[model samples]
Target: MAAGIEHGRRSRPNIRIIAWAGAAALLLVPLVAMQVTQEVAWDVTDFAFFGGLLLSVGGAYELLVRASGNATYRAAAAIALAGVFLLVWVNAAVGIIGSEADNANLLFAGVIATGVAGACLARLQPRGMARALVATALAQALVGMVALMGRLGVMSSAWPGDIFAATGFFAGLWLLSAWLFGRAARA
Candidate 1:
């Protein structure tokens, strides 16, 4: 039993290292693919920016996981990390509300801002996280509503379905995170 326990302890760090390695590979694959295909079209600056972003996001997630003892808090952090990554990637790749150039895309910043505030409010505690997650979900839902309005002809050129799709997806994630936090708080 002691030997088994010792083996399990050693494997935790190994799992973390493996996770980071996978993150690096996920970023590297696009770099190599871009080199081989003209369709991908990422330059050096794009590579550097995305590579750094991936590393920082993945490293932050790992740090939070190691720092938090509560499974609920860890899961919440993971969800927030994922939300940030997706937001950044989508914003960088092709604007969230429209394309990279649309002014409406600026509203997406609120989602990230709310998340930052939520983290501070929650302080990685289950009850606080529950409150924070609800706030985040509400913010996300508001963003979706605004996008829906923009899609309904408030904006002439914006695509309704795409905007609604992205907003709803992120909102759903926030809601799920909120539910998890609520469950954790109850437990």
Candidate 2:
């Protein structure tokens, strides 16, 4: 029993490090792609940075929820995820993040709505919460694909690459969130 406890203690940090590294890689891929393609010049407000931050936060939330085994932590994580969606929407609306044509506002609004609905469902049906979270993750992926296709100079000049990048970044984050939440549920 003592050996098992000691082994668990030693393994926790390794698990966290692996999670962080994976999140960093996911966040960096698109940014590197953008820089290589010259789609946009690198800047501080780049989507990769935001993506990394969101992933880190989501991962941290998961770790905390798992460690504490607290429902409140899970609820807070859900709320924080929703807040991130809302922030993206606001950024798109003000033209601070994406182009006018990207329609980030609408995409983010849908995400926010879905996230809120998922949270509500989670409260009512804990057993199916993971499914709701997974659905939100997929929705984010759809938004990313739309944003990406609309950008890259495919449809029109109105499409914004920044918005596409943001969506893609958050989609990755949501994927991480779903995995973490699912794992927590299982454990």
Candidate 3:
């Protein structure tokens, strides 16, 4: 009985496996879509890059969630991870501020960088994650404001609507994450 129980525990799939599988499924969606529609076009490099990115980010988040004892910390980490993944994926798929190659879109990376630096500084503590989340939220807002300025004719972008939409979506996610983290910290 003891041996069977231990074997069962060892055989169960871990969080890493689940994360990788989920990431693979997400990447496969576009690959399958490309077969039926011309709207989804991805080269080998794009597939590999995005696949690797999703897997890496998902695995990292899974590890963080599993290793943390605090529920609040786990929630904060998950929010931050999701925000980073979405921002990067959106920017890589199409330019947030303009075309995919638009220089203004690069500014959004600062938000992710801020989160990473905060994680390092806070050592992944709940309080630190809260502060980091707020900082990232601020960074996202700044990026959105820049995109809004472009929409107002302050920058060069024919697709100001796209810029506004992307910025608004991502900034909202950042703000939500910040709010969650703040609540966690307070609790």
Arrange candidates by lDDT, highest first: which order?
A: 1, 3, 2
Q: How many residue pairs clash in all the candidates, one count each?
A: 0, 0, 0
**Which pairs clash inside model 1?**
none
Cα lDDT tens digits for candidate 1, 33-108: 8879888988789889888888878877877676566687678777877887888888888776767777777777
lDDT by residue (1-187, candidate 2, tens digit) is 5644674564245645675677678667767787678764556666655675567566645654564454544653655455464455345434423544544446656765675587577762333455565677677667667656655334444456555666666666665556655665665
The local distance difference test score of each candidate is 0.75, 0.57, 0.75
Regarding TM-score, does 2 or 3 come out ahead?
3
Instruction: Give every collision pair in model 2.
Output: none
List of clashing residue pairs for candidate 3 = none
lDDT per residue as tens, model 3, 79-163: 7788788888878876677666777778887988998898789876667777777788788878778768656333544566666
The best candidate by TM-score is 1
Estimate TM-scores for all models.
0.83, 0.46, 0.79
Q: Show model 3 residue runs off by greater than 4 Å.
A: 1-16, 150-159
* lDDT at position 91, candidate 1: 80
lDDT score for candidate 2 against the true structure: 0.57
